[model samples]
Target: MSLLKKYCLLGAALWIACAAPAFSEYTALSTLLAETASKLEWNPLLESGVLVKDTTQVVFTVNVPWVIVNGSRRINVDAVRRQHGALVFPESTAKEIRAVLEQTDIPPKVFRVAAIVIDPGHGGKDSGASYVHTINGKSIRVSEKDIVLNLAKKLHVTLKARYPDKVILLTRENDTYIALEDRPYIANTIPVKPDDAIVYISLHANASMSSAAKGFEVWYLTPNYRRDLVTTASVGKEYSEIVTIMNDMKEEEFTRESVLLAGEIASQLESAIGAVTENRKIKEGEWLVVRKAKMPAVLVEVGFVSNLEEATRLMDDAYLQKIEKAIYNGVSHFIEQFEQSKGFTE
Candidate 1:
């Protein structure tokens, strides 16, 4: 054999051997399992030792001290050594690591939400509901439109104070009526690039004829209803495919995170107001407000204005201030929770 030919054949064999192991290694790992692996250019700090996989859990050692698994269809990583066998990741460390990985263009193992839209339901001629009261011996009427506007303003201020650069928008800042459909339309119209993370929150006060229902309640759109309605409504229409595409996009954007966010907000609200109000629990509702929103959307019924006692409280300036504080605290708590879980900051 000639010298050049032999060298060429040897080089080809080496390439094949190297390629074979790369392919084999990934093949042995399930796609779902492999997804748990960090896409960040594997750093020495993150990959100094071998990752040992066992039947129930996976472990890493030395510089590669993080453990990861696909839990509940999401990638969960923990630093087993630092926690002294605990499962939680500290917020500061996680945020730093995530920022580093993100800068390097690594697809995040979990998604984090940043921007939010707040909608205060009802306004203008809508009047919503009216309640009369005698204040200092003069009759006064409290309108739902005004109450919600004030609440939305308070929420926007609180969110911006915490998030700063995070975009917080309101559907209506004044008593002017904004159509039900236009609320979600504003969310959909936001010029968000594919890489941006945003969510929507619509605030409303619930009313009941019994005047007995009162408390804080949070809501995420009912998925089954939104999907079915969009699908059915689009059938035989020119934009059927468009509707399918949009529905699919919305599902991808919202579904999982929306539920988590709703729960977090509800929990915080309950904590904030527990001393003074009833706990109405978190729930899912199929209202048009939630259903049509393009992002992970939730509608919060802060309390029922129907209950005479609650109505009186709602009309009180001091009570409204308390409600504002509670709602703001809930939203802030939710944002912090989301950032921590997804390992993001700001």
Candidate 2:
């Protein structure tokens, strides 16, 4: 049987999980052809399938991965099938059709960097975690809040210098306290066009009773794509409704992008620090600052200030520069990759 027939049968037996893969992996062109006047015109020698959907045209080349939706080449293409009886296209190709049919809000072809929102965690009255050290019989104290704020400032300076025209906003420029809820608001409020991108980076210093907890880490929101965490039937009515509402508030696309941003930042940071805190690799974190942000967001723990050695290093301006530079480079890398994927140049 064709893949589409198999999936349809399977879906009937068991509800296809996760919103039914946005579109089935193997969608027979025959099915789409039968449903509409959309013609399946292909060249055997060229191994290409062209589906003309009104003004929008979807083109798929077999073996060679890539699809053209409405004349624009899309890289999200998987393998296009030309051998399975007629021709079957990958889900991405069908998704392109679904986007047009369903009127899905497709991202812009060109992505513009609108703003970079920086949140320096724990300020003003909140001293955060404290680390006390003695050097040459002299006592020194370092607070997580202070260290993070300093790093945030350096990062701001570096990013501003790099992208002078782009808006680089900080939740708190000084020692003044900003509530966790307010931080995301500040970022979400940034005026942006539909094609523009806004990234939220929340800086923080880690603290633990065990001084061994050292090294930098980045966090993104846990994936909730498969299950409806917001409306689980097992949970209480009031709580379930609240959770569902909150989960629904989070954009799945943004969460995926946030994960990518976190991974890039953590990889660069681990390289600079010369230590891979395996435990600190890109993982799920529900930090309010990151979770609530409407845009792609990540929370980075620069280092464990609780450790005497790390605390000492945090105090050093040179060390701070290195960490800040890594973060700056990571952000640059992310932007470059994002723009390239969207077919943006220069």
Candidate 3:
């Protein structure tokens, strides 16, 4: 079979994400091929792909900002990348190639993560769990609201820098009041196009009556919660009758995604999971991940504040930085894979 024929056959079987509207800065490889009638010969394992258009040829590498034209000329543009493990291209670079092998235009379709919402639990009038400790005769107080807010800000800053195209938000930017319901509401209200996803992460420091409690825990919503996720606005008025079924499907998707996300965060925290607490595990901690948010949401109980030793760790800027790195990296890794597959779990 011809290269084009083979790719066409594999496109459906492989669930290729190489399609995006021309309006987006990034163009999927499939759209580019349709526009230019090009043949793609690329190996995903090698993280590189090539496009053939009559006498013209283009070579692209994942995360590379430049493309090799005809194996001689170097053209710089946005890097060729895997759209959720599927091949895609930057519009700027694809346009140059398109000009060479002009063909009919077709609208491109794509799925991407449009936004991320970070919520810091307990703010303003809510002091949350307050504890005082004396280290070497110096008394210090730990405030749950303050610790989480600071950590949230750090995570927010890092994520915002990494995803300039995404909407990064914090429910409480400062030590201000925000209702529990309002936080997830902020996440759900974020305007997004079809096939676009938004994830919610609520940060909090756990407290227990037993001062010995320590270590970190990540939580996800169980399947029991039924939320009104599908509506005429989401599935269109024509499909409104099946909204209930769609909502169930959405709940399953969100549940699976939440589990995966929580696992990632838990895995990343292993490095710092220490002697203070035994057997750090994933748990159903707070209801923040529950009925409130209409998306894949997780609540991270970042160690137990009730324990003086652990409280000290949460309060420590250096220790908090470690948590920040772990959480940030965890979220980033999940986002990369999620967006790569366009949030397809199965």
lDDT tens digits, residue span 206-269, model 1: 7777767788888887655545424535333433323443344346436666786788778777
Off by over 4 Å in 3: 1-109, 232-237, 274-279
For model 3, the run of ten residues with the poorest summed lDDT: 100-109
- Candidate 3 on 112-207: residue-level lDDT in tens? 778889999989999888888875578987888999999999999999999999999998899898988888888988999866889899988888
Off by over 4 Å in 2: 1-30, 33-108, 225-250, 275-279, 343-346
TM-score of each: 0.62, 0.65, 0.66
Model 3, position 105: C-alpha lDDT score: 49
**For model 1, where is the 10-residue window of minimal lDDT?**
48-57
RMSD of each: 16.0, 11.8, 14.0
User: Candidate 3 — number of clashing residue pairs?
Assistant: 2
lDDT of 2 by residue, 109-191 (tens): 56767799988899998878787887447799888888888999999999999999889988998898878898999987788
lDDT of 3 at 258: 87
Give candidate 1's TM-score.
0.62
> Taking the candidates one at a time, how many backbone clashes does each contain?
0, 1, 2
